[model samples]
Target: MARELLPGQSPELLKALHILTRDGALNADSLRKLKQVNHLVRLLAPAIEDVLARFGDPVLVDCGAGKSYLGFVLHELFLRPAGKGSLHAVEARPELVAAAEALAARLGADRMRFERAAIDAAAPPARVHLVTALHACDTATDDALALAVRHGADHVAVVPCCQAEVARQLGEAAAPAPLLAPLFEHPWHRREFGSHLTNVVRALALRASGYAVTVTELAGWEHSLKNELILGRKVRASDRAAEDRLLGLCAAAGIRPKIVRLLFPAGAPAP
Candidate 1:
């Protein structure tokens, strides 16, 4: 008997994403992975629905889209029914882009487009309602945040990965004796601290850029190391305190990020 997914469920997408076997059975680990993906979609679904309710249709840009799993699943479940929105998957790897394009074509997902470009270099489209990045590595996640801000996107969702740059930089600097010694004694401690700093700075940056931010644990920390989702929505205008804290965090870490300049321009007041 042929396997079939319930209508509106995304079994085909899971197979296309290589998250499931051909026999339609999810293994112990695959189940965890699928759960995470499902939970992420669920978490973002309300926001998407809310936006659709307020504004007609929304354009979503998924950065570091990899094989476009999130894009495909989202389009299958959310954008398809609405029939008014589009999805753009931004990825730097040509092979992954090609694979995503093929899967999208096979799935008849006409509303989606796969672009081969890093988020930093991606050209701005007219309007984007939502921006998402799942496990985008290190500072690349920052680049995605900057892109979302540049486009004036209404919602920004990010899961950061492999935060090494800030940690390495922080290691070179001196922390206070007790805290500094223990933190620097082990490489892993330094990495963890860097990860923490990265997220904190990112949150502050988003707040400064006028977006209300929420940091939450993604459903699958055991399945994947990068399991924190940072969700932000534009609430009001730029916040001075957020910008000031962002600059202060950058200075303290000694890792100067270009996103700081982009998010908080020269004329902006200090936070």
Candidate 2:
């Protein structure tokens, strides 16, 4: 049963995305979905405003946009007639891409475009002002973050999922058998360790690449276990010491990332 959305409470785009259902009522699933989107929007609001102030009509790209839930909800709630910004969604899944495209068309959201592409390989339009990736898996989040850094995005928002890459890296590093053997044996332990290591490296990498990073819990844990949202802004330059340390961590883990070098040219000092 779908309950009607409260007046002035639900965003039309969210309704179309099925977060509100046909009747607008939010169920247990819808409630979780809404919380995630709402948290992201709140975090990005100030950054979006700042970008708009600088670049008349900012362009935003959503990578790994699984069904484009963020895109639809954002457009409905924030983007307006007076706002000339557009949202381009990059999704690898063909069905999701098609569904998102149809939904955008049905809603007359001319500014929204959905394309099929992996996060690592996505080529966005020239001059993107913002880049967002919600629940992008493992290194895919890094891929999206790399894109944001390369494109000089005014802002970037990411909620990461599945830290397998980092876990693998962590596993390769030598540690006491008594402590580390258990992590490798237990699925939950591996996931917890990997999640922590992934975010720590990511924050350091962003700082090394000239972005100020802020990490916070996105909504509540009930929304999802992958609830950490890392918000990055290009208000400051990179730090050479941080860059060295970041590279050192990769070296220590024996995993060579494609982003470190691209973001920090010649290992130059932070400007």
Candidate 3:
């Protein structure tokens, strides 16, 4: 009897992706990796369908694309079948970008392209339909969100990792809200509270910039510690209430993150 794979899931592509061994065997680690990305693809299916239904040809970007695994999987599961859009993988490392480009060619994924860019400097495609960042560390996730907002992207999804920037600032800054100072006065509490606050601020910032945000778990804790997924869909021009909330949160917390600076530089409105 032949081994069974998911429907329309190509073993050859999986082998090329190293998700499966050359002889088509799935290792323990590879299985875990595939499961994470596969689940994200499933979560994003509705957004893909919505963009395809609304637009003739869409452009999707993956920011801080490490090896472009998510990019390739997304293209394979969505763009390739539709044959109507492109997946642009943005990575800072030249070597990873080169390798991903070669892999795309080998897989005959002509529509998937690679670009070398820092998350903050990533250029927008002609029109951006979707933007995603997986495990982008520290403030890089903020850069990805800024990119999406600048382009007014139809959808945004990010799984942030190691939000150290806020934690570091929390240690140095005095709490404007005296009652809440206890939340981060200790080292352990500072780390945990800072991480939680970072995500909340991000969600509020997205809302301020006209996106309806959803925060959820990306996967089980066993799969990855960085499992928090922030998803957003464009809904309006902007929400001043959300903007005020974001401003108040930052002021009370006594921390101004990169996203706040990018979106509201010098206390001016977003462009």
Candidate 4:
């Protein structure tokens, strides 16, 4: 148990997070959590830097921010040093929000704010430059994506978790395509296929909303099961072809109409 420090990371902040004990020691669980936060920061830093370069004081929103770990790390390593950015962490749990607020106060993270609201209901007080949701459960990831689309954020990064919507749809109805029937035959297969399909649809939805999207692993499977990371950068125009493909996929997978409506609203061109 030694003081394993990440360059540019605040040791006191880590101590406050309980990632490191007061004696500067880390156990297995804390070390794993620290690694996870480090991985997230590494993945998101370049995009944040780009925004900072373009806009002197950009705003970042974290949806479904449980403990606001990502927001805090970003504030300490990126925002605080730049002295030109804001971090808003939105969470449904009031106690967690209070905890994050207290931590931010202790760490002197004046630029950070915590909201006790769900992803869909939370309103950012300012224009958002970037939107992020790490391991947002079930349809909450969709809420984050919709929030990005609605607010016209410059960038979005989300890692979706526990996607049961598609699986439930597939289980309720007969497979729309015979080829996919085998894939949905078993409960495990249904769950796995549903998760992959959900992300694909999400990427397509972002593309349709005028964002270039990239989907990749947030970390190794050994580190986390919810590893899929969807990164999006706003572009000039929406891709109609992507929208058509998304609709087609939904039809093939027998996804519910309500979900489709959530991704593609009325004004969005239909296939």
Candidate 5:
């Protein structure tokens, strides 16, 4: 059962996080959850290391921290060992925040802190190195991205969950191209198409705001249905060409994603 814990992760910590059973055995669901976080941490290693090297004390913020599992695991596997970085988990739930803070205290994770705040309202450190949101439902993910941009974060990694706005809008939307209506003409297709389209808009929005983005899978479909991973690295202040593409894409779809309105104000200059 000790092997059920991730390397460098203490059994006590995993048990506290409820990722490991009381007896230290990992159920299938727990193992899948661990795998997802493991892959994300590995994928984010280079970015974290680069920030630590340059900033000396990098600040990493995790929004919509359900159960704060990612925050705990990331702190244990990355920040605790690095000794020059801190992680702030922003979660609206008072219970989760309290639990995470209590766990941090137990582990002597002095660098870890939990704040009770919504994704959109949370204020991160002045100089944020990285921002992460795992499985932030619907528009909450957009709020996290907006927070990152406002703070001028160096990197952003998010695994969005439950994209429903675009899908709901599509129910009443008439495709700009009549031939394209089949993409979302039915209820099932609309949900699926809306999720895909929402991610595309988000990526373009990031690119327009100066991030070089890569969209890929977070983990296998079997591990989680909400598996789309969007990684962004800040490259410059802005990309006007990308902004044009993003705006044009929204116009064509007749739907403005939350990211579009969040990142791009009406007639506002691109950042």
Candidate 6:
């Protein structure tokens, strides 16, 4: 006898994703990974539904899409049910892109397409309704955010991972902020502070770009170390005060000019 399937989940889809074996059996590890992916999809479901309600045929771009697990699960659970929408999975690895493309074709996921491209270089044909970056490492997450903002995505969901940029910036600082000097004295503290500061700057940047930003734990710490989930919904007006605070934070941390320019462009108000 075969094991029971999750509601609304296709056995074929699971097998194609390799979450299930050829014999349609799942081990403990596969089940745990699937649960994690499902949890992430649930977190973004409300936002996706909102976009679908507003736009009849929504488009979603997934940056640094890796093996395209999130893209596949999202299409399976949401877009396929609606019988509309498209998902573009952008990955730098040719093999991963080819595999994803083949799997999508086999699954008859005609609306899904996999592209071989980096997050910084991906040029969407049109503005997308939603953007997602799951565990996009270091500056790749920033690249994804920049892409989303540039394309004017309606909703952005990102789970940043391995944020080394801020830590490196902190280490290169000629003079650390007086208030934060003690925290930066130790390597471990510097790593933790860098992670926190990176998220803060990112949230502020999104706010500066006219997004209502929310930061929450993506999952329990025990389950994943990279658990911070940042959700952003585009708004009509940008928050000048948040931008101002972001600038002040940068100055205090003695961030490099390049990073400042990347996060807050010139010709933007004095803030």
Per-prediction TM-score? 0.88, 0.84, 0.94, 0.92, 0.92, 0.91
lDDT of 3 by residue, 21-45 (tens): 7887767766666676578788888
State residue 89's C-alpha deviation in candidate 1, in Å: 0.4
Among the numbered candidates, top TM-score falls to: 3
How well is each residue in 207-265 modelled by candidate 4, as lDDT tens digits? 98899988888773355688888999999568888888888777777775333577676
Scanning candidate 1 in windows of ten residues, the lowest lDDT window is: 1-10
Better of 1 and 3 by lDDT: 3
Which lDDT tens digits does candidate 2 get at residues 1-271? 2233322245566777777666767778777766655666778878777776777778889989999988876676556543678888999999999998998888887778787999778888767899999888777888889889878888898888877865665555554235345654466666686677678778888887778889998765553688888998886766778788887666554444445545554642221
**Residue-by-residue lDDT tens digits, candidate 5, 80-181:** 888879998899999888877887888898888788999888877877889999889899999999988889899999999988998887776655456667
Which of candidates 1 and 3 is the stronger one according to TM-score? Answer: 3
Query: Residue 79's C-alpha lDDT in candidate 1?
Result: 85
Tell me, by lDDT, which candidate is best: 3
lDDT of 5: 0.83
lDDT of each structure? Answer: 0.79, 0.74, 0.84, 0.83, 0.83, 0.81
Root-mean-square deviation per candidate: 3.6, 4.5, 2.6, 2.6, 2.7, 2.8
Candidate 4 error regions (>4 Å): 1-4, 257-259, 267-271
Winner on lDDT (2 vs 6): 6
- Model 5 is weakest, by summed lDDT over 10 consecutive residues, at 262-271
What digit string (tens of lDDT, one per residue) describes model 6 on residues 1-271? 1334445777677777787776776777766666666777778989999988899788899999988878888888888889998898999999999899888887888889887988888877577889999988788888888888878899999998888877777887877679877877788988998888888888888998899999998663356779899999998667888778878787778664333466577622221
The deviation in Å at residue 210 for candidate 1 is 0.8
Off by over 4 Å in 6: 1-7, 256-260, 267-271
